[model samples]
Target: MKSYSAVVALAGLVSSVAAHGFISSPTPRQPGQGLKAACGDQVYNQQSSDHFGNVQGALQNLQGSQPDCRMWHCKGVPFSDAGEVFDYTPGQVIPMKVEIRAPHDGVANVSIVKVSSDTVIGQPLISWDQYALTSSPLSQHPDWTSFDIKMPDVSSECAKAGDCVIQWYWDAPKISQTYESCIDFKMGGGSGGSAPSPSASAAPASSAAPKPSSAAPATSATPTATVPAATPTPSKVEEVATPTASSGAGEGSTLPKSFTIDSFITWLRANAGSDTATKVSRAVAERAHPRAFRV
Candidate 1:
Protein backbone atom coordinates (compact mmCIF):
# COMPACT_ATOMS: atom_id res chain seq x y z
CA MET A 1 0.00 0.00 0.00
CA LYS A 2 2.69 2.50 1.01
CA SER A 3 4.89 1.37 -1.89
CA TYR A 4 2.08 2.11 -4.26
CA SER A 5 1.76 5.56 -2.78
CA ALA A 6 5.44 6.26 -3.27
CA VAL A 7 5.17 5.43 -6.94
CA VAL A 8 2.03 7.48 -7.34
CA ALA A 9 3.63 10.39 -5.54
CA LEU A 10 6.65 10.47 -7.80
CA ALA A 11 4.37 10.08 -10.75
CA GLY A 12 2.41 13.14 -9.73
CA LEU A 13 5.58 15.28 -9.79
CA VAL A 14 6.52 13.77 -13.11
CA SER A 15 3.89 15.77 -14.94
CA SER A 16 5.01 19.43 -14.69
CA VAL A 17 8.81 19.13 -14.71
CA ALA A 18 8.65 18.34 -18.39
CA ALA A 19 11.61 20.52 -19.27
CA HIS A 20 14.32 18.59 -17.40
CA GLY A 21 14.70 14.87 -16.58
CA PHE A 22 14.59 12.39 -13.68
CA ILE A 23 16.22 9.09 -12.85
CA SER A 24 13.95 6.20 -13.92
CA SER A 25 16.10 3.24 -12.90
CA PRO A 26 18.04 1.58 -10.04
CA THR A 27 15.59 3.34 -7.79
CA PRO A 28 16.75 6.75 -6.48
CA ARG A 29 15.97 8.34 -3.07
CA GLN A 30 17.13 8.98 0.50
CA PRO A 31 17.26 5.86 2.65
CA GLY A 32 14.46 3.64 3.93
CA GLN A 33 12.55 1.68 1.26
CA GLY A 34 12.51 3.97 -1.78
CA LEU A 35 12.65 7.60 -2.85
CA LYS A 36 10.37 8.57 -0.03
CA ALA A 37 12.61 6.74 2.37
CA ALA A 38 15.72 8.75 1.48
CA CYS A 39 14.11 12.04 0.68
CA GLY A 40 11.43 12.14 3.39
CA ASP A 41 7.68 11.69 3.15
CA GLN A 42 7.07 15.41 2.90
CA VAL A 43 9.25 15.87 -0.19
CA TYR A 44 6.33 15.20 -2.44
CA ASN A 45 4.29 17.88 -0.75
CA GLN A 46 6.70 20.68 -1.70
CA GLN A 47 6.52 20.24 -5.43
CA SER A 48 4.99 23.22 -7.25
CA SER A 49 3.60 21.15 -10.11
CA ASP A 50 6.46 22.49 -12.18
CA HIS A 51 9.19 21.77 -9.65
CA PHE A 52 11.76 20.33 -11.96
CA GLY A 53 11.46 22.35 -15.13
CA ASN A 54 13.58 25.45 -15.62
CA VAL A 55 14.87 25.56 -12.08
CA GLN A 56 17.96 27.77 -11.91
CA GLY A 57 19.72 25.61 -9.37
CA ALA A 58 19.74 21.89 -8.76
CA LEU A 59 18.20 21.86 -5.29
CA GLN A 60 16.67 25.29 -5.68
CA ASN A 61 13.12 23.98 -5.34
CA LEU A 62 13.64 21.93 -2.20
CA GLN A 63 12.74 23.58 1.08
CA GLY A 64 15.71 24.53 3.33
CA SER A 65 18.05 24.43 0.40
CA GLN A 66 21.58 25.32 1.53
CA PRO A 67 25.22 25.02 0.61
CA ASP A 68 26.69 21.57 1.17
CA CYS A 69 30.35 22.20 1.87
CA ARG A 70 31.21 18.84 0.38
CA MET A 71 28.78 18.70 -2.50
CA TRP A 72 27.51 21.07 -5.17
CA HIS A 73 24.40 21.71 -3.02
CA CYS A 74 22.23 20.19 -0.35
CA LYS A 75 18.80 20.52 1.22
CA GLY A 76 20.28 22.20 4.38
CA VAL A 77 18.49 19.69 6.54
CA PRO A 78 18.13 16.07 5.53
CA PHE A 79 14.98 15.73 3.52
CA SER A 80 14.61 12.18 4.78
CA ASP A 81 17.32 12.28 7.45
CA ALA A 82 20.03 10.24 5.54
CA GLY A 83 20.74 6.70 6.97
CA GLU A 84 18.44 4.49 4.89
CA VAL A 85 20.51 2.61 2.33
CA PHE A 86 20.34 0.52 -0.88
CA ASP A 87 22.44 -2.44 -1.98
CA TYR A 88 24.08 -3.08 -5.35
CA THR A 89 26.58 -5.62 -6.62
CA PRO A 90 30.18 -4.86 -7.45
CA GLY A 91 31.37 -5.55 -11.01
CA GLN A 92 27.80 -5.57 -12.20
CA VAL A 93 27.00 -3.31 -15.11
CA ILE A 94 23.92 -1.78 -13.57
CA PRO A 95 21.43 -0.09 -15.85
CA MET A 96 20.59 3.60 -15.22
CA LYS A 97 17.98 5.19 -17.41
CA VAL A 98 16.54 8.71 -17.49
CA GLU A 99 13.42 10.32 -18.87
CA ILE A 100 14.25 13.69 -20.39
CA ARG A 101 11.03 15.65 -20.59
CA ALA A 102 12.22 18.68 -22.52
CA PRO A 103 15.05 18.12 -24.91
CA HIS A 104 17.89 20.63 -24.79
CA ASP A 105 20.41 18.25 -26.31
CA GLY A 106 22.43 18.49 -23.10
CA VAL A 107 25.00 16.16 -21.56
CA ALA A 108 24.75 13.72 -18.66
CA ASN A 109 27.28 13.00 -15.94
CA VAL A 110 27.19 10.51 -13.06
CA SER A 111 29.19 10.52 -9.84
CA ILE A 112 29.35 8.34 -6.74
CA VAL A 113 30.28 9.18 -3.16
CA LYS A 114 30.96 6.70 -0.36
CA VAL A 115 29.44 7.59 2.95
CA SER A 116 30.53 6.26 6.30
CA SER A 117 27.03 6.64 7.68
CA ASP A 118 23.62 7.50 6.33
CA THR A 119 23.75 11.00 7.77
CA VAL A 120 27.05 12.13 6.29
CA ILE A 121 27.86 12.66 2.65
CA GLY A 122 31.41 11.43 1.97
CA GLN A 123 34.06 12.79 -0.29
CA PRO A 124 34.12 11.78 -3.94
CA LEU A 125 34.73 8.11 -4.59
CA ILE A 126 33.99 8.30 -8.31
CA SER A 127 33.24 11.27 -10.53
CA TRP A 128 32.28 10.51 -14.11
CA ASP A 129 31.05 12.88 -16.78
CA GLN A 130 29.31 12.06 -20.03
CA TYR A 131 28.56 8.51 -19.01
CA ALA A 132 25.23 9.04 -20.72
CA LEU A 133 23.64 11.58 -23.02
CA THR A 134 26.69 12.24 -25.16
CA SER A 135 24.83 15.36 -26.18
CA SER A 136 21.74 16.96 -24.66
CA PRO A 137 18.33 18.47 -25.60
CA LEU A 138 17.25 14.94 -26.24
CA SER A 139 14.80 14.94 -29.12
CA GLN A 140 12.20 17.67 -28.56
CA HIS A 141 9.01 18.28 -26.62
CA PRO A 142 6.04 16.03 -27.48
CA ASP A 143 8.80 13.56 -28.31
CA TRP A 144 10.31 13.21 -24.84
CA THR A 145 13.46 11.16 -25.08
CA SER A 146 14.94 8.35 -23.04
CA PHE A 147 18.62 8.20 -22.14
CA ASP A 148 20.06 4.80 -21.40
CA ILE A 149 22.98 5.31 -19.01
CA LYS A 150 25.74 2.77 -18.47
CA MET A 151 26.56 2.86 -14.78
CA PRO A 152 30.14 1.91 -13.99
CA ASP A 153 30.72 -1.02 -11.69
CA VAL A 154 31.35 -0.42 -8.01
CA SER A 155 34.50 -1.54 -6.23
CA SER A 156 34.01 -4.52 -3.99
CA GLU A 157 35.61 -2.64 -1.12
CA CYS A 158 33.14 0.25 -1.15
CA ALA A 159 30.15 -2.06 -1.58
CA LYS A 160 31.01 -4.17 1.46
CA ALA A 161 31.58 -1.00 3.47
CA GLY A 162 27.97 0.05 2.81
CA ASP A 163 26.25 3.43 2.29
CA CYS A 164 26.81 5.38 -0.91
CA VAL A 165 25.08 7.80 -3.24
CA ILE A 166 25.00 7.84 -7.03
CA GLN A 167 24.35 11.33 -8.35
CA TRP A 168 23.26 12.29 -11.84
CA TYR A 169 23.62 15.81 -13.19
CA TRP A 170 22.41 16.87 -16.62
CA ASP A 171 23.79 20.01 -18.25
CA ALA A 172 21.12 22.25 -19.69
CA PRO A 173 21.85 22.64 -23.37
CA LYS A 174 23.27 26.06 -24.34
CA ILE A 175 22.76 27.24 -20.78
CA SER A 176 25.24 27.24 -17.87
CA GLN A 177 22.76 25.42 -15.67
CA THR A 178 22.49 21.84 -14.43
CA TYR A 179 19.74 19.60 -13.09
CA GLU A 180 20.78 17.22 -10.35
CA SER A 181 19.30 14.02 -8.92
CA CYS A 182 20.56 11.06 -6.88
CA ILE A 183 19.94 7.51 -5.70
CA ASP A 184 21.54 5.84 -2.70
CA PHE A 185 22.87 2.30 -3.03
CA LYS A 186 25.33 0.04 -1.19
CA MET A 187 27.68 -2.27 -2.97
CA GLY A 188 26.63 -5.88 -2.37
CA GLY A 189 29.67 -7.61 -3.78
CA GLY A 190 32.34 -9.79 -2.21
CA SER A 191 35.41 -8.13 -0.67
CA GLY A 192 38.14 -9.75 -2.74
CA GLY A 193 37.22 -7.85 -5.89
CA SER A 194 39.65 -5.35 -7.44
CA ALA A 195 39.55 -1.61 -6.67
CA PRO A 196 41.31 1.38 -8.20
CA SER A 197 42.45 4.92 -7.38
CA PRO A 198 39.69 7.02 -5.84
CA SER A 199 39.98 9.31 -8.86
CA ALA A 200 39.77 6.25 -11.09
CA SER A 201 36.50 5.43 -9.36
CA ALA A 202 34.59 6.50 -12.48
CA ALA A 203 34.08 4.91 -15.90
CA PRO A 204 37.12 5.74 -18.02
CA ALA A 205 35.71 4.34 -21.24
CA SER A 206 32.53 6.36 -21.12
CA SER A 207 32.83 8.92 -18.33
CA ALA A 208 35.12 11.07 -16.14
CA ALA A 209 36.59 14.60 -16.12
CA PRO A 210 38.13 15.69 -19.39
CA LYS A 211 41.37 13.89 -20.19
CA PRO A 212 44.37 15.51 -18.45
CA SER A 213 47.68 16.65 -19.89
CA SER A 214 51.26 15.56 -18.95
CA ALA A 215 52.56 18.94 -17.87
CA ALA A 216 52.58 18.38 -14.10
CA PRO A 217 55.52 15.95 -13.75
CA ALA A 218 57.88 16.42 -16.65
CA THR A 219 61.06 17.50 -14.85
CA SER A 220 64.18 18.33 -16.82
CA ALA A 221 66.30 16.92 -14.00
CA THR A 222 64.72 13.47 -14.44
CA PRO A 223 63.71 13.10 -18.06
CA THR A 224 63.32 9.30 -18.38
CA ALA A 225 61.71 6.55 -16.29
CA THR A 226 61.24 2.78 -16.42
CA VAL A 227 59.21 -0.35 -15.39
CA PRO A 228 55.95 1.57 -15.84
CA ALA A 229 55.64 2.12 -12.13
CA ALA A 230 52.28 3.34 -10.89
CA THR A 231 52.01 5.12 -7.54
CA PRO A 232 48.98 2.83 -7.49
CA THR A 233 47.46 0.92 -10.39
CA PRO A 234 43.71 1.14 -10.00
CA SER A 235 42.38 -2.32 -10.75
CA LYS A 236 38.81 -1.44 -11.63
CA VAL A 237 38.40 -1.89 -15.37
CA GLU A 238 36.08 0.48 -17.20
CA GLU A 239 33.50 -0.92 -19.59
CA VAL A 240 33.36 0.87 -22.91
CA ALA A 241 30.40 1.48 -25.21
CA THR A 242 31.94 -1.22 -27.39
CA PRO A 243 33.33 -4.35 -25.79
CA THR A 244 36.92 -5.15 -26.55
CA ALA A 245 37.80 -8.35 -28.34
CA SER A 246 38.80 -10.74 -25.61
CA SER A 247 42.50 -11.33 -25.44
CA GLY A 248 43.72 -14.87 -24.82
CA ALA A 249 44.41 -13.90 -21.21
CA GLY A 250 44.77 -16.77 -18.80
CA GLU A 251 42.80 -17.26 -15.59
CA GLY A 252 44.47 -14.33 -13.79
CA SER A 253 43.67 -11.66 -16.35
CA THR A 254 42.76 -8.32 -14.75
CA LEU A 255 40.97 -6.86 -17.74
CA PRO A 256 37.46 -6.76 -19.16
CA LYS A 257 36.49 -7.78 -22.66
CA SER A 258 36.71 -4.19 -23.81
CA PHE A 259 39.42 -2.97 -26.19
CA THR A 260 39.99 0.31 -24.39
CA ILE A 261 43.05 2.51 -24.71
CA ASP A 262 43.73 1.86 -21.02
CA SER A 263 43.61 -1.89 -21.54
CA PHE A 264 46.13 -1.60 -24.34
CA ILE A 265 48.28 0.47 -22.03
CA THR A 266 48.03 -2.29 -19.44
CA TRP A 267 49.20 -4.77 -22.05
CA LEU A 268 51.97 -2.39 -22.97
CA ARG A 269 53.04 -2.10 -19.35
CA ALA A 270 53.75 -5.79 -19.31
CA ASN A 271 55.22 -6.25 -22.79
CA ALA A 272 56.02 -2.80 -24.14
CA GLY A 273 59.49 -2.63 -22.35
CA SER A 274 60.49 -0.40 -19.40
CA ASP A 275 61.38 2.87 -21.15
CA THR A 276 58.23 2.81 -23.21
CA ALA A 277 56.17 1.78 -20.18
CA THR A 278 57.65 4.58 -18.04
CA LYS A 279 56.90 7.22 -20.65
CA VAL A 280 53.37 5.92 -21.09
CA SER A 281 52.83 5.43 -17.36
CA ARG A 282 53.74 9.02 -16.55
CA ALA A 283 51.67 10.17 -19.47
CA VAL A 284 48.71 8.16 -18.16
CA ALA A 285 49.05 9.64 -14.69
CA GLU A 286 49.42 13.12 -16.10
CA ARG A 287 46.27 12.55 -18.10
CA ALA A 288 44.33 11.65 -14.96
CA HIS A 289 45.90 14.55 -13.05
CA PRO A 290 49.11 16.40 -13.74
CA ARG A 291 50.11 15.82 -10.13
CA ALA A 292 48.37 12.42 -9.91
CA PHE A 293 51.45 10.43 -11.12
CA ARG A 294 54.67 9.58 -9.27
CA VAL A 295 57.72 7.30 -9.50
Candidate 2:
Protein backbone atom coordinates (compact mmCIF):
# COMPACT_ATOMS: atom_id res chain seq x y z
CA MET A 1 0.00 0.00 0.00
CA LYS A 2 2.92 2.41 0.82
CA SER A 3 4.53 1.65 -2.57
CA TYR A 4 1.23 2.43 -4.35
CA SER A 5 0.92 5.76 -2.55
CA ALA A 6 4.54 6.75 -3.51
CA VAL A 7 3.89 5.81 -7.18
CA VAL A 8 0.73 7.95 -7.21
CA ALA A 9 2.68 10.98 -5.74
CA LEU A 10 5.42 10.57 -8.39
CA ALA A 11 2.76 10.47 -11.18
CA GLY A 12 1.18 13.72 -9.92
CA LEU A 13 4.63 15.55 -9.88
CA VAL A 14 5.34 14.31 -13.44
CA SER A 15 1.95 15.59 -14.62
CA SER A 16 2.63 19.04 -13.07
CA VAL A 17 6.03 19.22 -14.82
CA ALA A 18 4.51 18.11 -18.16
CA ALA A 19 1.91 20.94 -17.99
CA HIS A 20 4.67 23.58 -18.50
CA GLY A 21 7.16 23.04 -21.32
CA PHE A 22 10.65 22.40 -19.95
CA ILE A 23 13.90 23.67 -21.51
CA SER A 24 16.64 21.03 -21.72
CA SER A 25 19.43 23.69 -21.75
CA PRO A 26 18.72 26.67 -19.47
CA THR A 27 19.38 30.02 -21.18
CA PRO A 28 20.09 32.83 -18.64
CA ARG A 29 17.93 35.90 -19.34
CA GLN A 30 19.51 39.34 -19.64
CA PRO A 31 18.88 42.01 -16.97
CA GLY A 32 15.56 43.87 -17.40
CA GLN A 33 14.51 41.45 -20.18
CA GLY A 34 11.45 40.08 -18.31
CA LEU A 35 10.70 43.27 -16.36
CA LYS A 36 7.66 44.07 -18.49
CA ALA A 37 6.28 40.58 -17.89
CA ALA A 38 6.71 41.00 -14.14
CA CYS A 39 5.36 44.59 -13.94
CA GLY A 40 3.58 46.98 -16.32
CA ASP A 41 5.41 48.98 -19.00
CA GLN A 42 4.38 52.37 -17.49
CA VAL A 43 7.40 54.54 -16.68
CA TYR A 44 6.22 55.44 -13.18
CA ASN A 45 5.00 51.94 -12.34
CA GLN A 46 7.80 50.08 -14.06
CA GLN A 47 9.87 48.10 -11.57
CA SER A 48 13.64 47.69 -11.94
CA SER A 49 16.40 45.97 -9.99
CA ASP A 50 19.75 47.34 -8.86
CA HIS A 51 21.95 48.22 -11.83
CA PHE A 52 25.19 47.96 -9.81
CA GLY A 53 23.82 45.29 -7.44
CA ASN A 54 24.80 46.94 -4.13
CA VAL A 55 21.72 47.53 -1.97
CA GLN A 56 23.26 45.71 0.99
CA GLY A 57 26.42 47.76 0.56
CA ALA A 58 24.53 50.94 1.51
CA LEU A 59 23.25 49.51 4.79
CA GLN A 60 24.91 50.50 8.07
CA ASN A 61 27.58 48.06 9.21
CA LEU A 62 26.51 45.91 12.15
CA GLN A 63 28.66 44.04 14.61
CA GLY A 64 27.94 41.19 17.03
CA SER A 65 24.26 40.40 17.66
CA GLN A 66 21.78 42.55 15.65
CA PRO A 67 18.05 43.05 15.36
CA ASP A 68 16.03 40.66 13.18
CA CYS A 69 15.22 42.06 9.70
CA ARG A 70 11.63 43.40 9.77
CA MET A 71 11.86 45.56 6.64
CA TRP A 72 10.16 43.05 4.35
CA HIS A 73 7.09 43.03 6.61
CA CYS A 74 6.96 46.85 6.87
CA LYS A 75 4.71 48.87 4.54
CA GLY A 76 7.44 51.12 3.11
CA VAL A 77 10.97 49.81 2.89
CA PRO A 78 13.19 52.58 1.48
CA PHE A 79 15.64 50.33 -0.30
CA SER A 80 15.89 46.64 -1.13
CA ASP A 81 19.11 44.69 -1.22
CA ALA A 82 18.32 44.04 -4.88
CA GLY A 83 18.19 47.82 -5.53
CA GLU A 84 16.46 51.11 -4.71
CA VAL A 85 12.99 51.45 -6.23
CA PHE A 86 11.28 54.86 -6.38
CA ASP A 87 8.98 56.85 -8.65
CA TYR A 88 10.86 59.86 -10.04
CA THR A 89 8.35 62.66 -9.61
CA PRO A 90 8.20 66.16 -8.15
CA GLY A 91 5.80 67.36 -5.42
CA GLN A 92 5.50 63.82 -4.15
CA VAL A 93 6.00 62.64 -0.59
CA ILE A 94 8.84 60.11 -0.46
CA PRO A 95 8.98 57.70 2.46
CA MET A 96 12.39 56.91 4.02
CA LYS A 97 13.25 53.93 6.21
CA VAL A 98 16.51 53.28 8.05
CA GLU A 99 17.68 50.64 10.51
CA ILE A 100 19.56 52.01 13.52
CA ARG A 101 21.11 50.03 16.44
CA ALA A 102 22.32 51.77 19.55
CA PRO A 103 24.28 48.76 20.94
CA HIS A 104 25.20 51.00 23.90
CA ASP A 105 23.61 53.44 26.33
CA GLY A 106 23.13 56.90 24.71
CA VAL A 107 20.76 59.22 22.84
CA ALA A 108 20.50 59.60 19.08
CA ASN A 109 19.88 62.99 17.49
CA VAL A 110 19.07 62.83 13.80
CA SER A 111 19.01 65.99 11.69
CA ILE A 112 18.29 66.24 7.97
CA VAL A 113 19.61 69.11 5.82
CA LYS A 114 18.38 69.31 2.23
CA VAL A 115 20.58 71.15 -0.27
CA SER A 116 19.14 72.96 -3.32
CA SER A 117 20.00 76.12 -5.28
CA ASP A 118 16.99 78.09 -3.97
CA THR A 119 18.31 77.67 -0.42
CA VAL A 120 19.04 81.22 0.71
CA ILE A 121 22.08 82.18 2.83
CA GLY A 122 20.07 82.31 6.05
CA GLN A 123 17.09 80.13 5.06
CA PRO A 124 17.14 76.57 3.77
CA LEU A 125 15.43 75.60 0.54
CA ILE A 126 14.02 72.54 2.34
CA SER A 127 13.71 73.41 6.00
CA TRP A 128 13.82 70.73 8.71
CA ASP A 129 10.50 71.92 10.14
CA GLN A 130 8.84 70.78 6.91
CA TYR A 131 9.69 67.10 7.49
CA ALA A 132 11.01 65.37 10.60
CA LEU A 133 11.20 61.97 12.32
CA THR A 134 9.41 61.32 15.57
CA SER A 135 11.61 61.03 18.67
CA SER A 136 12.10 57.38 19.60
CA PRO A 137 14.71 55.47 21.55
CA LEU A 138 16.74 52.72 19.89
CA SER A 139 17.46 49.43 21.68
CA GLN A 140 20.71 47.47 21.57
CA HIS A 141 19.32 45.19 18.85
CA PRO A 142 18.72 46.28 15.26
CA ASP A 143 15.50 48.36 14.91
CA TRP A 144 13.85 49.63 11.76
CA THR A 145 12.83 53.32 11.95
CA SER A 146 10.65 54.77 9.22
CA PHE A 147 9.92 58.42 8.34
CA ASP A 148 8.61 60.40 5.38
CA ILE A 149 10.41 63.34 3.75
CA LYS A 150 8.67 65.41 1.09
CA MET A 151 10.53 66.48 -2.01
CA PRO A 152 10.83 70.26 -2.44
CA ASP A 153 8.66 71.93 -5.07
CA VAL A 154 10.08 71.84 -8.59
CA SER A 155 9.19 75.52 -9.07
CA SER A 156 11.89 76.40 -6.54
CA GLU A 157 15.26 77.25 -8.06
CA CYS A 158 17.02 74.98 -5.62
CA ALA A 159 15.35 71.91 -7.10
CA LYS A 160 17.76 70.05 -9.37
CA ALA A 161 17.75 66.72 -11.19
CA GLY A 162 20.19 64.49 -9.37
CA ASP A 163 20.58 62.21 -6.39
CA CYS A 164 19.52 63.74 -3.05
CA VAL A 165 21.65 62.61 -0.11
CA ILE A 166 19.84 61.57 3.07
CA GLN A 167 22.34 61.40 5.93
CA TRP A 168 21.64 59.49 9.16
CA TYR A 169 23.87 60.19 12.12
CA TRP A 170 23.64 58.04 15.28
CA ASP A 171 25.20 59.61 18.36
CA ALA A 172 25.97 57.68 21.60
CA PRO A 173 27.13 60.00 24.35
CA LYS A 174 27.66 57.27 26.93
CA ILE A 175 29.78 55.15 24.62
CA SER A 176 31.28 58.10 22.76
CA GLN A 177 30.63 56.54 19.39
CA THR A 178 28.76 57.73 16.30
CA TYR A 179 27.60 55.96 13.14
CA GLU A 180 26.55 57.64 9.90
CA SER A 181 24.87 56.26 6.77
CA CYS A 182 24.22 58.20 3.54
CA ILE A 183 21.72 57.16 0.89
CA ASP A 184 21.71 58.84 -2.54
CA PHE A 185 18.33 59.15 -4.27
CA LYS A 186 17.93 60.23 -7.88
CA MET A 187 15.65 63.24 -8.62
CA GLY A 188 13.81 63.57 -11.94
CA GLY A 189 11.74 66.16 -13.87
CA GLY A 190 13.02 69.11 -15.91
CA SER A 191 12.78 72.71 -14.77
CA GLY A 192 9.36 74.33 -15.03
CA GLY A 193 8.92 77.19 -17.54
CA SER A 194 10.09 80.70 -16.69
CA ALA A 195 7.88 82.94 -14.53
CA PRO A 196 5.50 85.30 -16.38
CA SER A 197 6.64 88.87 -17.07
CA PRO A 198 4.77 91.57 -15.13
CA SER A 199 2.83 94.03 -17.33
CA ALA A 200 3.21 97.80 -16.64
CA SER A 201 -0.20 99.53 -16.37
CA ALA A 202 -0.39 103.14 -17.60
CA ALA A 203 -1.21 105.79 -14.95
CA PRO A 204 -4.01 108.37 -15.51
CA ALA A 205 -2.94 111.89 -16.67
CA SER A 206 -3.42 114.74 -14.10
CA SER A 207 -5.24 117.95 -15.11
CA ALA A 208 -3.46 121.33 -14.60
CA ALA A 209 -5.24 124.54 -13.35
CA PRO A 210 -4.73 127.99 -15.09
CA LYS A 211 -3.11 130.90 -13.10
CA PRO A 212 -4.93 134.33 -12.58
CA SER A 213 -3.40 137.29 -14.57
CA SER A 214 -4.62 140.52 -12.76
CA ALA A 215 -4.68 141.35 -8.98
CA ALA A 216 -6.92 143.96 -7.05
CA PRO A 217 -5.29 146.81 -5.02
CA ALA A 218 -6.08 147.57 -1.30
CA THR A 219 -9.01 149.99 -0.76
CA SER A 220 -7.79 151.44 2.67
CA ALA A 221 -7.04 155.27 2.56
CA THR A 222 -4.10 155.05 5.11
CA PRO A 223 -1.14 153.14 3.59
CA THR A 224 0.75 150.62 5.72
CA ALA A 225 3.98 152.12 7.30
CA THR A 226 7.29 150.33 6.48
CA VAL A 227 9.94 150.07 9.29
CA PRO A 228 13.54 150.99 8.32
CA ALA A 229 16.26 148.38 8.95
CA ALA A 230 18.56 149.25 11.94
CA THR A 231 22.30 149.61 11.30
CA PRO A 232 24.27 146.46 12.37
CA THR A 233 26.35 147.02 15.57
CA PRO A 234 29.68 145.17 16.08
CA SER A 235 29.83 142.95 19.18
CA LYS A 236 32.37 144.19 21.84
CA VAL A 237 34.85 141.60 23.17
CA GLU A 238 35.00 141.65 27.00
CA GLU A 239 38.44 140.99 28.56
CA VAL A 240 38.63 138.34 31.28
CA ALA A 241 39.53 139.79 34.72
CA THR A 242 43.08 139.02 35.86
CA PRO A 243 43.76 137.76 39.39
CA THR A 244 45.13 140.49 41.70
CA ALA A 245 48.63 139.72 43.05
CA SER A 246 48.95 139.46 46.83
CA SER A 247 52.28 139.81 48.66
CA GLY A 248 52.14 136.21 49.76
CA ALA A 249 53.84 132.97 48.78
CA GLY A 250 52.03 129.70 49.20
CA GLU A 251 51.97 126.05 48.07
CA GLY A 252 49.53 127.16 45.32
CA SER A 253 52.34 129.23 43.74
CA THR A 254 54.40 126.04 43.26
CA LEU A 255 51.63 124.36 41.25
CA PRO A 256 52.44 123.49 37.62
CA LYS A 257 51.61 126.13 35.00
CA SER A 258 49.32 123.70 33.20
CA PHE A 259 47.00 123.50 36.23
CA THR A 260 45.71 126.42 38.32
CA ILE A 261 44.83 125.49 41.93
CA ASP A 262 42.40 128.45 42.35
CA SER A 263 40.62 127.69 39.08
CA PHE A 264 40.42 123.99 39.95
CA ILE A 265 38.95 124.86 43.34
CA THR A 266 36.36 127.18 41.73
CA TRP A 267 35.43 124.51 39.18
CA LEU A 268 35.04 121.89 41.93
CA ARG A 269 32.76 124.25 43.92
CA ALA A 270 30.54 124.85 40.88
CA ASN A 271 30.44 121.21 39.81
CA ALA A 272 30.13 119.80 43.35
CA GLY A 273 26.60 120.90 44.24
CA SER A 274 26.76 117.72 46.39
CA ASP A 275 28.21 117.95 49.92
CA THR A 276 30.59 114.99 49.25
CA ALA A 277 32.44 116.80 46.47
CA THR A 278 32.63 120.07 48.49
CA LYS A 279 34.21 118.31 51.48
CA VAL A 280 36.64 116.31 49.30
CA SER A 281 37.76 119.41 47.37
CA ARG A 282 38.20 121.53 50.52
CA ALA A 283 40.30 118.84 52.23
CA VAL A 284 42.52 118.31 49.14
CA ALA A 285 43.04 122.05 48.67
CA GLU A 286 43.86 122.73 52.35
CA ARG A 287 46.38 119.86 52.47
CA ALA A 288 48.01 120.30 49.04
CA HIS A 289 47.90 124.09 48.61
CA PRO A 290 48.18 125.86 51.96
CA ARG A 291 48.33 129.69 51.75
CA ALA A 292 51.59 131.31 53.04
CA PHE A 293 51.48 134.60 55.02
CA ARG A 294 53.71 137.49 53.78
CA VAL A 295 56.38 138.83 56.21
Please give, for residues 2-56, the per-residue lDDT of candidate 1 as tens digits. Answer: 2223423443344324356665555544222233333334443332233344323
What TM-score number comes out for model 2? Answer: 0.24
What are the Cα lDDT values of the candidates?
Answer: 0.37, 0.25
Estimate the TM-score of every prediction. Answer: 0.38, 0.24
Off by over 4 Å in 1: 1-18, 30-85, 115-162, 189-295
Which predicted model would earn the best TM-score?
1
Per residue, candidate 2 scores C-alpha lDDT tens digits across 31-92 of 23233322223211211332111111112111222243211111012222213323234444
Model 2, residue 123: displacement in angstroms? 8.5
How badly does each model clash, as a count of residue pairs? 16, 3
Candidate closest to the true structure, highest lDDT: 1
